[model samples]
Target: MDEAAVKEFIGTEISRSTVVVERSAIAFFASAVLDDDPVYTNADEASARGFEAIPAPPTFPFVMQNWGAFAELQAEGGQGAGLGMVLGPLMANGGLILHGEQAFVYHQPVLAGQTLTGVGVIKDAYVKESKGTTMTFVVAETTWSDASGAPVVTTTFNIIHRK
Candidate 1:
């Protein structure tokens, strides 16, 4: 991909999605992630643990976009263009698009039965040369907020394009 294209993608809104946090989905996610915690499956257990409801496993928000909200957005006439829009150029160039890193900053515990809206932006993009290979790193940040419009969590992930 050219520098001009990369520059254009940086700081752009790549994705917007809204997800409903279902109790069943949280339980399923916990099982999938190998977290067999009682609080994730039983509301009573979660209540004893001082939670109002069953809490989603950590990293659950990462799937909120691709698994549900993105599909909904797509059905709404491609409103949620998502990360694909940001990585399309790099991917079209016949190179590898790889996940580099992911991080989450939680302002509140995400519990079941709440709705979250997320907006992701290409925060930064740059290129590095290593061992004669060109590597482009893109940083994307998404902020998830509750229905009341308060921030719930902020997630930052890096995608690397290598040629």
Candidate 2:
């Protein structure tokens, strides 16, 4: 995936002000991931455990920042293009897209019902030649914050588009 267009995405803020975090979203994500953590599903359990409400499990922020409003973000008037948009041009150029890596760091627990905002940027885009193959790597970082502007979680996504 050596298209110049894909390279232009480096440093681009692909997603901004993504969506708010809610209790239902947390519970659903927890269920989908088979977390089965009471803090993510039961408000009473979370409260008894010293949380104001059901607290999201780790990695919940990524769910809200990525798939939460992905449909809207990929369309016109949203970010330049969502993940799929970037993947298309890459795949068309004899490249294969793969999930390279992912990491998350939590500064604070994301509370249920708190309206949150997210921002993401294509941190880097580069090509590497190894094993007689040329591989393109795109790394993105998205941070979710609370209404008070305190960051809750920072997630880094690494994608490999290989040819």
The reply for model 1, stretches above 4 Å from the true place, is: 70-78
Candidate 2 positional error at 23, Å: 1.8
Least well predicted 10-residue stretch by lDDT in candidate 1: 70-79
Q: Candidate 2 on 1-163: residue-level lDDT in tens? A: 4547567888887776656567788888899889987878888889889988788878777677544554553335665455665677777757677889999999888887676667788888888889988888889998877778899889999999777
What lDDT score is found at residue 85 in candidate 1? Answer: 81
Per-prediction TM-score to the true structure, in the order listed: 0.90, 0.82
Report the lDDT tens digits of candidate 1 across residue range 1-163.
6666677888788777787788888888999999999999999999999998888888999886645553553325454577788677678877888999999999999988777888889999888888988898899999999889999999999989999
Name the regions of candidate 2 deviating beyond 4 angstroms.
Answer: 1-8, 66-80
Give the TM-score comparing model 2 with the true structure, all chains together.
0.82
